[model samples]
Target: MRHVIALDVGGTAMKAALTGLDGTPLYEERRGTGRERGPEAVVESVLRFAEDLSVLGRERLGTAAEAVGLAVPGIVDAGRGVAVHAVNLGWREVPLRELLGRRLGGVPVALGHDVRAGGLAEGRLGAGRGTGRFLYVSLGTGIAGAIGIDGAVEAGSHGRAGEIGHVVVRPGGPACGCGGRGCLETLASADAVGRAWSAASGDPDADAADCAGAVESGDPVALRVWQEAVDALADGLVAAVTVLDPRVVILGGGLAEAGDTLLAPLRAAVAERLTFQRLPALVPAALGDAAGCLGAGLLARDLLAALAVRT
Candidate 1:
């Protein structure tokens, strides 16, 4: 069977899949990124992970992988196969695709931004399928987005197109890692919600899911915190809708997992705030955690197609 190696590397974990040509998984696995061990170790782990997947494909499926696709966090230069910067992984200007390819016997490698790859999968095979234009917002530890047009996710010039998290939603609200005050992520991301809830509930380990549970049980404190986060999220999303005018906005990540608790209020708030811009249908992500892996497979397939065309 013809197969490709697909990998999605996150802050602490890496999800990988050996996939058939039609995007069906032949093998899937998860492992730590070893980021705590430092950047060099993390890079070594990624290369080893790809090689292991390739070997597994050959042994189990009786075919060598034709290509490899990788989706990684931070600022990425996909066209140049470089991971420009990732604060969590301590990477800067790393030639990931080139390195992985050399380790895999010169097999073709397709590299992309993790969120953009997820958006690609969403546009082709998940919630945004058939939607000509949409925004994929991931409300995880930090917020990020991908602008999907037709079947492709736009990477923008300088590879920072869909960074909605840094958009200032509250003036002088909170400090952001991006050196901005009152950015959307600082107020509304999963990590942000967790921090607020923990401080209010006096549970040092409390997270966003706990906040959602409290909201469901009608806790006044939780409600206040949740509502504040939702309002800020709507502000940032409204800005995106006004500028991009997407047909729909697909929400994913840990915070979005709250389901209706998050979506219901978000929809209402965004609707109330809208003036002349068209309201976008806000929907939950269909693929969940698998979107990035599936998207990596798609990228691999696209690379094969382009190579074949050239020949």
Candidate 2:
């Protein structure tokens, strides 16, 4: 069976799969990223994991992988196949595609931003399926987004296109890791809500899930925190909708797990903020955590298609 290696490298874990050309997974595995051992160790771990998967594919299916696709967190230069920077992983200008290609005996490799890759899967096979235009946002430890057009996610000219998290929604509110104040993620991300709830509940270990549970139980303090986050998120999203005009907005990641508790109020908030722009259908992501790996498989398949066209 001819297959491709698809990997989604997160800050703390990596999800990998050996996938058939039709996007079915033949084998799947997950491993810790080992960032605590340093970036070099993390890269080595990824290479070893891919090599093991390749070997496993050959042993089980009687063929080697034809290509590889990797989705990683950080500032990615997809056109250049480089990972420019990832604060969490401490990577800088790493030629990930070239490195993987070399390690895998020169097989073609595609590298992409994790959020963009997830959005690609979501747009093509998940919530945004059949939609011509949409935005995919992940509200995790930090917020990030991907803009989808037609069947593909746009990486923008500089591969920084869907950075909605850094958009200034509150001007002078809170400091952001991106060196800005009042960025959307600072107020709306899961980490932000956890912090706020921790303070409000006077429990240092409180997190966003706890906050959501509290809100579900009708706790006034949790409601306040949740609403604040929702308001900030709505502000940032309106800014995006004003510019992108996507027909659908797909919300994913940890915070999105709140389900209707998040969406009901969020839909109302976004609707209230809109004036003349078309209201988009706000929906939950369908793929869950599998999106990035599935998207990496799609990337590998697309690379093979492009190569076939060239030949």
Candidate 3:
């Protein structure tokens, strides 16, 4: 089978992989995205990454690549290959397909939202495998979710679905980057935990990983901060679970790195809240950060299939 290139584009780094049609990675590459310089800089980074992969694929796979699949952070109109907005990267309304397709000699390009693509990976080869209904949540710099049902990722009417982070939780709590106060993300995200811990401890430079380390050392401040974060996250998960009724809830990204430190408390919180409701099994994402690239590759693979039908 021919190969496809999978690239997950973020504000800070890019993860690229060569994957089989069956969604298996044949080879992988990782590099900094360096988007701080602006939109053109990001496009340039992607071009370089793709060029590297094209060379690697030619040498290793011994086959011409089928297409390119790129997943980007922020609001993506994947159907149109556009990056609508990425405030963190100072990018707006980027025509990713046109740029990448041109760079790769007009190879078909599939642009996708990072979270949905990651969820797609879960559906195809990770925790959501074999389950028709699934929700994959990534807890990192911020929180986002993707819903999959019947083996297809759900993109809402305007290419946004499973955006559970903005839901109001405290109503008057901390402010959020999205111009809301007491939003779910303000309370539940890894950044939120770090900020909350820092505020409570009077340490302006503290981060979530520091708090986690503090927990490991039996620090009351970190323990309390972690519990609050877990509770808020469980609240959001309950809402998602109640709405989707997924067979599995897959958590991935930076926060999930805490492993049992996060999973054990999270499981207990969800179980406690679901006393009178159906509970979904909670699982960690198997693909780690590669999930977005893997899913993006599958998007290209699906496009190839669609083209075949038309032909």
Clashing pairs for predicted structure model 3, backbone only: none
Query: What TM-score would every model get versus the actual structure?
Result: 0.98, 0.99, 0.93
Which one wins by TM-score: 2 or 3?
Answer: 2
The residue-by-residue lDDT of candidate 1 on 1-311, one tens digit each, is 99999999999999999999988888999999999899999999999999988888889999999999999999999989999999999999999999999999999999999999999999999999999999999999899999999999999988899999999999998999888999999999999999999999999999999999999999999999999999999999999999999999999999999999999999999999999999999999999999998999999999999999999
In the range 1-311, model 3's lDDT, one tens digit per residue, is: 47899998887988888888776779888998777677788789888899889878888888768888888888899878889988778778988899889888988888889999999988988889998998999888888899999888999989989888887778888888888887788887888888888888889998888888888888997899999989888988998888888889999988888888889999999999986678888889999987888888988898888888999
1-311 per-residue lDDT for model 2 (tens digits): 99999999999999999999998889999999999999999999888999999899999989999999999998999999999999999999999998888898999999999999999999999999999999999999899999999999999899999999999999998999999999999999999999999999999999999999999999999999999999999999999999999999999999999999999999999999999999899999999999999999999999999999999
Candidate 1 wrongly placed segments (more than 4 Å): none
The TM-score of predicted model 1 comes to 0.98
Please, what's the RMSD in Å of model 2?
Answer: 0.6
- Lowest summed lDDT across 10 adjacent residues in model 2 is found at 95-104
Using TM-score as the yardstick, the better of models 1 and 3 is 1
lDDT of each: 0.96, 0.95, 0.87
